[model samples]
Target: MEDSYRHKGMRRQLVKVVRSKGIKDERVLDAIGKIPRHFFFENALVEHAYQDKAFPIGAGQTISQPYTVAFQTELLNVKPGDKVLEIGTGSGYQSIVLLELGAEVYTIEYQKELYERTRFALPEMGYKANFFFGDGSLGLPRFAPYDKIIVTAGAPTVPDALIDQLKVNGCLVIPVGNAKTQQMLRLTRLEGNKLRKEVFHDFKFVPLLGDDGWKK
Candidate 1:
C-alpha cells in the first residue's frame, strides 16, 4: 500500500536526520525507527509524528523531540536487560524507546490524566514500562537500585533522592536549569558516596514538577 511505503520512508528519514544531528547509538537509532510515534499523539497530529518534532499531548506536557529522546536514551547508557527508571511518563514515547533498548523500566508521572493515558496505551503497544502515578521528581523509591535513570522533564537541579536511589556505578541523565532554560546533566555514581557530574549543552523542556524541581 502507498500509505505503508510512505510510513517507511518517513521512518528512514527520521533516522537519517537524527543521526546527522548527532545521535550516535545504533540501539537508540533502531529503537526510534521502530516505534510508531503517531500513536502517542492526538489523531489530528498522527501525520506529523515522524517529523522529529515534539507535539503537545494534553495535561501540560509535550512529547519530547525525537532526537532528544534518542540523545537521552544513549546518555543513560542503557544495556540489554538493564533496570531503568524513567521519570515523567509523558506521551509514553520515551518509555517505548527504553523498552526497545531492552531495559526493564519503571516510570512515574504526576498529572492524573497523562498518567492514565499512558497506562492505557502501553499494553496495547506491547510495552512493559511499569507505570506509576506520583510526584516524579521524588523518583520511584520502590524501584531503587536501577542500572540507569532518565528524566524526560527538565528540573531546576538534580535531586538528592534520585542520587540515593541509583545503584553504585549507575548512571542518571537529567535536564537541569532554571524553568525557562535547561542544560543536560549526566551523573554517574562512583565508589562510596561519590558522584561524577558531566554537564552538556543547553536545552529546554517542560518544568520538572516536584519538591526537587520547580516551585509547584
Candidate 2:
C-alpha cells in the first residue's frame, strides 16, 4: 500500500482532468485530488488509477470514472458532519471521497467479495466508514434519515427505500436507466416527503442488484 510522490503527482493531474470536465466544487475536487486512488488498484493496474476512466474492481463492478465520482459528489452537496449513505461500496473509493468531504458515512455493498474486501481495505488505508454487507437497493432502514445518499450502480428506477431514507432537504444522487446506461439524477427530499428531482449526465454502470433493483 505504497503511495509514492509519483502517485500524488498523478492525482494532481487527475484533479485537473476532473476540474476541466466541469466539476467546480472545490471540496469535491480536493477530495479527488487527495485520495490515493492507486491504492485501490493492484500494482499491475496502478497506472490506470488516475486516467479519469472507470476500471474493473472485481465482482463485475467498476471504480467509476473520476469525473463521474466528482459529479455525483458535487450533486450530493455534503456538509461537514452530514450523515451519508452510500450504496455499492465497490472498491470503497467513493466512500473515501465522502469521508474526505467530512461526512459520516454508512456504506453498504451487495457483492460479498467486494463487501469483505473493502471492509478491510479502507481502514487499512486510514479511511473508515460504517460498512455493511447487504442488498443496497433496499437502503439501510435501521439508520433511516440520512443527510445524503449516493448509489454507485445503475438502477432500473429510483428505489423507494433510498428516497424514504433521506431527511427533509436531504439529497440523493443516483443513476437511473437501463442496464447499459443511466441518467444521473438528484432528488432532494422536500417538506411533506415530496421530492425535487433534477436529471443530469448519462453514464453506464453495473446493474444494481437487490430486492428493489434489478432481479438477480
Candidate 3:
C-alpha cells in the first residue's frame, strides 16, 4: 500500500530494464518510475511487482508487462493534454502511465469486475481518468476523434471502428495477431482516412473480446 524508498528503488531498476529493451522515450521512462506498480497487485504478488512481466489482476486480465507498456506508450508519442482513448483498462496501470505524462485519458474496460475495481482504485492512487465499461472494440463514439488510441489486448485484426475514431494525424497502437501472440502495430492516421502502418515487436496479450474482437 505504501510506496516506500525500496519501492522507488525497484522502479528505477525497472526503468533501466525497460530502457535496455529499447524504450528510449525519456518521458515514458520517467512516468514508469513514478507510478507505483505494486499498488495494482495483491500483497502476495507485490514482491514481483517491479519485474518486467505480466501478472494476473483477476477477471482473466493481466497487468501488462512494464516493457510492453513503455513500448506501446512510446509508439503513441503522447503529448501533454492529448486526448487518449485506451481500449482496455486492465489493472489501470497503462492509464496511470499516460496520466503521469499529462494526457487526458479516457479508458474503457470490458470486464465488469476489473472495471469497477479500477474505477475506484485509480483515483485513490492520485490518478484520474475517464473510465467507461463496455465493448472497447466499438470505440467511444461519443468522445471520438482522439489524438491517440491504445489497445491493450490482442486482436485478430485492427478494428475499423478504432481507426474511425482517431483524429487526422492521430496515432493508434495495438497488438494484432492470434490469441497466442501478437505483432505490435502503430497506425498513424493520414489525410483522406488513410493510415500509415508500422510493425514492431511481438507480444502476448489477453484476447480482445467484443463484436469487433474475438467472439465470445
Candidate 4:
C-alpha cells in the first residue's frame, strides 16, 4: 500500500516536472512515469522519491534530479530496442530509465561502492543492464558501436575513445568542462569518418575521472 502511494506521487511529480521543463518527447515522458525511483534508494527515501532534486547516495555521488534526468534522456533521442552505453551508473537510475524505454543497457561505474550497491538495487527493480566496474571515461571498447552512449559524468573534453565506439549515425550525450563545473555536449557520428557535435545544456556533474577526462 505504501509503495503504491509512493509510486503514485512520483508519477504525478514526473509529469508535472517534465512538462514544465519543456521535455516534449512523449516517449521520454512515459518512460519517466513508468520507472519507480524509490526502488533505487534505501528505505529512507521512499517518501521523498518524488522531489525534483538530487539526493545523496553516499560515496560523494548523487542520484540526479528528475528534471536533469528527464532532460538528459530526452537529449539522447532514444528509441525502442536501441542499444545504450551508459557511463557513471550512479544509483542505477539513468540505466533504469533507459531500460524502461526499451533500450538494451550496458553501463559502467567507476566507484566500487556505488557499483555494488547499484548492482544489488537494480535487479530488484526488474532491469538487466550489463554493469561494469571500471573507469567510465574509457568507453567500453569491448562493446563497440553502440546505438546511443550516455555519460552522466563531466569531462574536460570529449573522449575520443567514446567517439570511436559510436555506431554510424549513433550519438553520445556527455558533459565537458573543468573541475568546478561542466557543460553538456552531444556528439553524433554522421558517416564515412565524419562526425558532428552540439552543446545540449549547461549543467554540472562530478568530474569524469580517467585518461580521457579531468585528471582529478
Best by lDDT: 3
What tens digits encode model 2's per-residue C-alpha lDDT throughout 1-216? 777899999999999889889999999999998899998887888889999999988888889999988999999999999999999999999999999999999999999999999999999989889999999999999998899999999999999999999999999999999987899999999999889999998999899999989989
Q: Give the TM-score of candidate 3.
A: 0.98
Model 4's TM-score against the true structure: 0.94
Ranking by lDDT: 3, 2, 1, 4
Query: Candidate 1, 73: how far from true, in Å?
Result: 0.8
Which residues of candidate 3, in runs, are more than 4 Å off?
none
Whichever of 1 and 2 has more lDDT, that candidate is 2
- Candidate 4 per-residue lDDT, tens place, 22-63, comes to 989887777778777776666876766777778888887889
Q: For each candidate, what TM-score against the reference?
A: 0.96, 0.98, 0.98, 0.94
Tell me the deviation in Å of residue 105 in model 3: 0.5
Worst 10 residues of 3 by lDDT: 38-47
Candidate 3 residues 103-126, lDDT tens each? Answer: 999999999999999999998998
Worst 10 residues of 2 by lDDT: 38-47
Name the regions of candidate 2 deviating beyond 4 angstroms. Answer: none
Clashes per prediction?
A: 0, 0, 0, 0
- Model 1 clashing residue pairs (backbone): none
Looking at candidate 2, what is the lDDT of residue 29? 93
Residue 53 in candidate 3 has what lDDT? 94
Task: Give the C-alpha lDDT of model 2.
Answer: 0.93
